[model samples]
Target: MNFLIISKYFYPQNRIASFRINAFAKYIRNAGHSVTVIAEGDHDMDTEWNGCKVSYVKNKIITESYLRDKIKRRKRWTVRRITASLLNRIFLDYNLFWGFRVFKKANKLFKENRYDVVLSSYMPISPHLAALNLQLAGHKFFWIADMRDEMSKHPYFSKKYKSAYIAIYERLFLKNADLVLSVSKPILDDFRKMHSSSNYLEVRNGYDYEEVYDVNFQSKFTMGYIGQFYDKIKPDNWFHAFSELISEGRIPKDSIIKIIGNNMKIKIPDNIINNVFEIESVPHDEAIRISTTEVDVLVMIHPLGRKGVYSGKIFDYLATNKPILALYDPDDVVGDLLRETRAGFTVKESDIEGIKSMILKCYSIWKNREVLPRDWNKIKQCRRFNQTKILLDYLSEHLPNQ
Candidate 1:
């Protein structure tokens, strides 16, 4: 089978969006299938990565350039705000311009080659827009629209100025997809609700478990949090809990909280200021190395009310084989996975006492040099290679004719 993957994010971009599709491309090609990737980049290039053919295409938004130039030249805040708002309403999404460019490129690619399947992943939504255009133009290949995150009903963008208009586009484009893939069950449920006639499946983000690292515990009990906090997924509650734990001396005074990323400014409590450390974002491989060897426990944060969000970092934490301290809604899929894998504890953001207790428990295990028992069998299933196999098996079973 020949696979054409269209994603706005791909290899060499140290982002969560790039990992899943990168894994898919590699493993699918390793399975003796031809895989070609069309990815967004600063410049166009035709190259091969991980045994898969790749075409990196440059993408630009005209309105964004115009807005920036106008704002810079005029220094008129009011005009800039109004113009941005008007443009947002007109475009519905900033990526629409890039989407059209991708559509044109995809059309040309289709004419030049025969593809058995086209898998388009989303975040900026340009890839899906391109694939949707191909479908509407009467292409007969099996199309899989992979949503790493939601679009129209995304929690962060739910109240955006053009959400309704975005929803209309989402429906029209996705309804034509032969199959819709999402990262979680709740997200697939939402898609099923929105497009009842379309087929939906869950293809989760996973870690590269094949890359192993030696575990070297930090001298002081350390807890590390990677990636930026977005929307309601702030670390304020966790910070408060840690402060209380330190004040009560429930945890060692030398215990450290290392935040690894270009996170938003956080007001550290006076008591815990000395205990907290911040590190700038590192390469993805280095981040994994730090997670595995430097930190005693890995921290994961999900918004209290959000469901179906398993931050891509969680899988990496799991691969580290270290205990996880996830501050998330106890009823969400994240909590469910943690419980099933016995990877770590899950405490709701509002449960300060619960959070403190979990912290102390993890601290105790580290202080005692005790290793937590994990479901290695279940953990193995979450590896990127295994996840890709599952996706391929599902595709084979469900779309056998293709």
Candidate 2:
């Protein structure tokens, strides 16, 4: 099968969408299928991935030397307006302007030689709409809509948008798709409520095997986190959870708290600075090696908000079989997974005392060398690669195979 993947993020960017799309494309290619990716350009404009072809597009008008020079001089003021006007003209979806040229090339390529399927992943929802355009142009390719996050239904949306407009748009658009997939059940449930398509499914994010099997677990008392960081994920809360340990001297004052992602550049609240050991972001393989060197506990933290905002890091953390400390909303998807594994504890973010108790308990478990029952065997069987196979099969059976 030939698969054309449309996304705004792809390899070398190292964000979630890029990583996820790369995993699928690699697997499908390994399975003896061809996969072509259309995405926004990073520092590298046009390139060929391992076995896959990738192309990028961006607006030419806004990229003039004069505009770039002016922005360089007054970036603090002119950037917003420049971005808005430039992006609107270039991309069908304003945010995905970098993919405009890529999509045009893809459309031309599709016309020359048809593909078996067109799969799109969303952050900027333009890919699906772009696929809709291709499908309308007499192309019989199967369209799979992959939603890594809830569109307008995300918790970050204002009440007005979620309650009214999004419901209608999601229903109308998704109804036309051959299949709709989300990373978790809550999101799938939201989709099912508005659209009764049995075509809907859940193909979750998973760990990379090389990251799990290749690295040596080297640290004795180091705690680690391996993903992007942002304001919503309060590092202070993590510090507060271990405050009792620090006060009582259970964990050494110099014990490492390594955070290995681009998030080091984000502004962190001053309260948490004393507890950290910083490492600059690296390539995925390097990150895996760095994370595996840690000996103590593995921590995954997210904002304590609505259910379903689980970072992809949690799955990778699970595969490592380290003692896990997941700090997230009780209702979040990652929290639910921790409950299912019974491998870790989920404490309320506000209950700093409870979080302290859990940390102490985890430290004790770490000391005892107790191996909790991890579902690594199950994880290997049900990752994104295998999930894509299942998705293709379902689409073939239910939708046109063409």
Candidate 3:
């Protein structure tokens, strides 16, 4: 079978969305299916990766620098705001020409060799729009649209006002897709309610075991959080908990506490400074190398309303076989996974006491020179290959069983 995977981001992009697409393409190819990934990348950067072919789609407009320059050139703040708004309206999900370029490429690809399935993965929604374009152009392939983040429930964009226009594209993609999959069940449920006619599935972001690398275990009792941080997901509870522990003398003064990648941007209280360290963001491979081996405990921070979000980092942390201190919903999707794998502890976003308990507990174990014994039997189910196999089987079942 021939498959075309359309995603704005792909392998080497180092994002959660990219992990899923990269895994899908690699495993599908390994499963004896010919796979081609079409992603936003360097112009003419077509290459074979992990047993699959990759084609790049260059954006003619709406790049970060281009947008910044356009906005900066506007003298009036009001004019800048208006120009940005217009840009968003003109581009499909702020990716001007991405959809059109993909459509043209996909049209040609279909004309040359008809694909058994065309998987469109999204955050920007441009790839899905490309699939829609192909369908409208009368090139009907079995279209499967993968939603990394449920745009309908986007936090920043108000559904009633700001993203009303975005809703149109969302509805069209859902209505036209033969099957739609989201990374979590909550997202799947939301989509089912919105588009009952569309078949929905839960496709989680799994960690690639093949990419797992070794790192020498350090002696220091270290807790590391790898990934970008923003206002929505600051480890406030973790900080407060650590502060309390320090005051109580539970956590050693030499204990390592680091937040790698983007700055937390939250005001870090001076009390925790003795334990604090920050590393600039590294690429995905480097991050895994650091977190899986060096960090004694992995810290995962969940923002408000993350019930359905089983973060991609959790899978990586699980692969490490290290204890996780999840600052998340105690009973949410991520918390459930932690219990299932026997991976680590979960403290709610607001539970300072709970966070403190987990911190103290993990530190004791780390200090003892012991690692968390994970249930590999249960963990294997969440492996990238295994996850992709299930998805492919479903896709095969949906196809005419020849």
TM-scores of all models? 0.91, 0.84, 0.90
User: For model 2, which pairs clash?
Assistant: 57-98, 219-295
Clashing pairs in 1: none
| TM-score head-to-head 2 vs 3, winner | 3
Please say which candidate is ahead in TM-score: 1 or 3.
1
Ten-residue stretch with the least lDDT total in model 1: 62-71
lDDT of 2 by residue, 252-357 (tens): 5555577776433443334345767667667777766655666567787776655676678776676666767877777677777787765567777677777787
lDDT for model 3, please.
0.79
C-alpha local distance difference test of each model: 0.82, 0.68, 0.79
Give stretches of model 1 more than 4 Å off. Answer: 62-89, 211-215
Steric clash count of candidate 1: 0
Q: Clashes in model 3: which pairs?
A: none
For every candidate, C-alpha RMSD to the true structure in Å = 3.8, 4.4, 3.6
Task: List model 1 lDDT by residue over 68-152, tens digit each.
Answer: 3454355446554565456566675556666777787778888988889999987766788888888889887988888888777
Model 1 scores what on Cα lDDT?
0.82
Judge candidate 2 at residue 198 and give its lDDT. Answer: 43
The Cα RMSD of model 3 versus the native structure comes to 3.6
